[model samples]
Target: MVLRRIFPAMYTAKDSEPANSKNGTLYLLRCVFFMGVRKPPKRYFLAYCLWSFALNLCSTFYQPIGFMTGYVIHLSEFSPGEFLTSLQVAFNAWSCSTKVLIVWYLVNRFDDANEILDEMDKRITQDSERKRIHEACSLSNRIFFFFMSVYMMYATNTFLSAIFIGRPPYQNYYPFLDWRSSKWHLALQAGLEYFAMCGACFQDVCVDCYPVNYILVLRAHMQIFAERLRQLGSDPHESEEERYEKLVQCIQDHKTILRFCDSLRPVISGTIFVQFLVVGLVLGFTLINIVMFANLGSAIAALSFMSAVLLETTPFCILCNYLTEDCNQLADALFESNWIDYSKRYKNALRHFLHNLQQPITFMAMNVFTISVGTNISVTKFSFSVFTLVKQMNIAEKLSKTEEEVENLY
Candidate 1:
């Protein structure tokens, strides 16, 4: 519902036929602009970049950092169960903070990516292709957000529990304010944390959605681009000269697509690497919570939280997997083209193009590993391994402590 203005889940035929798809992009940018996540307009003669930094901290990076300040500092004092909670929160903090830091430092690269996307959008001349891209983007948004909303339901538990239990979400240290001194102070603090939570979730969603959404749009463009490749020299009405011109245009568009990929490499590589690094531990802790927590609410939270994490992280791999496949399909597409009778120049260009596509266009995570669905399985296996080790250690500790108690009694 929140993103309906930008990308409607259910739109009629006429509704999809806008003057341009740039409106949705504009609407999203306006929302992110107000949040100070996106770079401010150049028209603002003296815009302070610090506002974006401040907003990033408050919106996404602060709460977990705040919670950890108390729990993490005195880590040796907490029991295993207590420490697990802190660890879970810490892993999450690392993920969110790293992404926030990336945004703060790399906002301009992000702007480049967005502008390139709009340029790519303008290249889609056919109404049918535009509608197809529109529907694909809309479907991607709906699926992404539906899981996100479910996870938000899980996150809402923190706020709900705060309201019912009359305590803030975290028992973290706040050096600036004595928020726990009185009911009013506590109430005010809770209100602020709630505000922070809403803002943080929204910004984090946008941060993630930006690159992924742009890439998804690029992927859609390539899908059309591939079909266009297959249609080369098919129109006999056009002379050989005309068909050759069309091939040149196709090659130019392909280069634009490649430039888009080059721009996106910087935008996604580091983000994906850090995200992959955390998934193992985060999933391990949450899986442990589901297995160990006797409380129904805690178990549900753990389960839902695990589901949300998977929803949030896994689809990137899945999407990249599909995108990789789409890119490879271009080779076959060009080969299948009716270029048998085309000019020598067209065949030479097509041959070079097919050769480039021959080496499958796979994106890597920080140049470390290929982003694909296989990574998802590997992550899951690593998480289960961590869960097993942690589980056995916890059980062994309980048994050893029990024996010590018996010995003392004896």
Candidate 2:
């Protein structure tokens, strides 16, 4: 009975959802058989993931290529403000490139990613703990739903802008190609752009939400683990041998949890770090754009972009930070165990367990940046510093140009 309680049934239904995570984040893979799991027979879901990946890859190149082409062909006619606007789009494309990389990472590492869910399903067997896990997923799903909703709306806005408003978001992406010569060709390109748009929308949604969900799920498991620690040795009817077995089981549980973390670190490190770098640079550009553009429209747009960025990035930062707090509380939870009343051997085993808990499980990105609010906070500080340096250089460059003109006049 104790063994049953400790290890799960080891059987997963053939048609169970790919991400038994119960979170809306990997909604992209919900279509058909993905990685290894079978789902509803609609293969379009997988097709869409592929479709989005391809178009996003094209767009990832289109943005910078178009911008650079303009600089080369129209260098004499280039306006700094126009270049800035295009540069912003180029940066946005750079973001798409990173997203593409993340999507590729997630798809390539799908099984390892699923282990997180498997671990949760295996360990969270008790009814009360299952309820708590469900609650945590519900909360996380709501937050991610909000994030997805905002992004989808943004995509909808872009769609409307391109189709109805006659303003393509990535205008001139096909420079030197005349779309006006043939209405049929123009319409065809528009349709293809729409396809690409769907790809990007799906890609961004998956990349942004899953890492945060992974952190939240890990946090929930840690909470349950802590509760288990606090309950150790509390049963009066169980024999001494039973208590020893349970303690051994608890040690195994801790080891499994750490292994889950190890699996997760590789899965998310690239995604989250790439995400942080992209968002940080865009945030920096947006900040500088606000000061550089005194026009009311530009200001409002910059503020809106900044808000969308924070909405997307903030949850990952906050939740991952909470994971650290959960780890910190494990030692206390072990102390809450009724170890004082146990035999010396049991007490000694618990002592070793407590010592292992001292190091704590922290999610580090590329094993460099500690994945937490502190790391995110540093990204923002770095953004601000870059913003300052850019502004100073712009001012100094203008001053130097003026001085040269004055010397020429003299």
Candidate 3:
């Protein structure tokens, strides 16, 4: 399949292999989905735009209609469960807008994604430790794809439940405000909305996975560079001049890796920031909905959906942490090398490299929040706080209603 050829692995097959032979199923999916092409064809570009437009339109309207119906018109006053549902609906609508923004960012900055892939391809093909790095990257890609597949299954199941079981055939949760009540009309509306959600989810996975691949490749390069640094003066057959040359080459590689990290920031930082920001709210609302209606079938399905959302948002933090740790290890690796045995000039070069490594290569979210394990911790804490607050409010509202009923009895 063309998709399989386009979507699977970052590294191309060895030149000795037949071009036709390289088009394996797994490889093509990896290429098409995550490892985007340098120049996407016109049709692909148009499809991307159409998908983005649909998502944007749906998300853009979803929130306003939810607010008007839930708050302004007080439609959710009938029950606490309905109120919780309203809040979750509003939050999901808002979060979808963020997805649209991320999709837009990914489409606009696709060239940067292609460049990262190209750099990875070069390193995997040319590096002496290609086999090790290739294996590591392949492992990471598999883990990523496995997570995505699980999320997709969960999402599909949730959507199907929402369509068949959660709502009447001639109605949906979509705030279409005014429309014909025909079953076919409702089905068509629900189908378009479902299609938009699926498309956005797929795009979201692709955009997020691109950064994962880049970070993995970057970590691989750093590992290889660290090994070279460690082996700098250990080769007995190499002369002083040869050792110095190798040291210079290692310095150059370090700089290239750093430059690549810089190039990656602009492509992903804003999208990651938005993702982190929204995940907290989404999680909070989902939790509130689950607690309010624990036995409700719709709530159970929504819980599954939100679990998938969390899984999707988590890799940004994990991969960023990995990159930071890998970059920091460069200094330690260099320090542990046989640098003391080298000439003064070579020692000076080591000093320069160590100085560079002092500032660890860290990814930022929107140039403000650093993406790390700590950020993940902070987001979790924030989500918990929001959930607690919403839970308390619900409790208080219930208590107030109980008191009102008691007064009427008196």
**Best candidate according to lDDT:** 1
Expressed as tens digits, the lDDT of each residue in 312-335 for candidate 2 is 567777887677678779988998
Candidate 1, after superposition: displacement of residue 2 in Å? 12
Residue-level lDDT of model 1, residues 309-374, one tens digit each, is 675567777788787788788888989989887678878977887887777666788888787889
State in Å the error of residue 117, model 3.
5.2
In terms of TM-score, how similar is model 2 to the real structure? 0.76
User: TM-scores of the models, in the given order?
Assistant: 0.83, 0.76, 0.76
* Candidate 1 TM-score versus the reference: 0.83
Among residues 3 or more apart in sequence or in different chains, the pairs in candidate 2 whose N, CA or C atoms overlap within 3 Å are 52-199
Between prediction 1 and prediction 2, which has the larger lDDT?
Answer: 1
The digit string of per-residue lDDT tens for model 3 on 1-410 reads 67546654544434343222112123323433432322345778877666445554554445335445446554423344445544554555455456545545555354454454455445333434665555555655665566567656655655565566433211224555332466675567556546545544554555556566556556656777777677678888888899888778777777667666676677577667776776777677667667655346656666765766666557767877777778678888888888787789988988987888867777788888888778877786676788888666777467448656856776
What order do candidates take by TM-score, descending? 1, 3, 2
**Candidate 1: stretches off by over 4 Å:** 1-28, 40-54, 57-64, 72-83, 162-167, 176-189, 395-410
- Please count the clashing residue pairs in each candidate, in the order shown: 1, 1, 14
Clashes of 2: 1
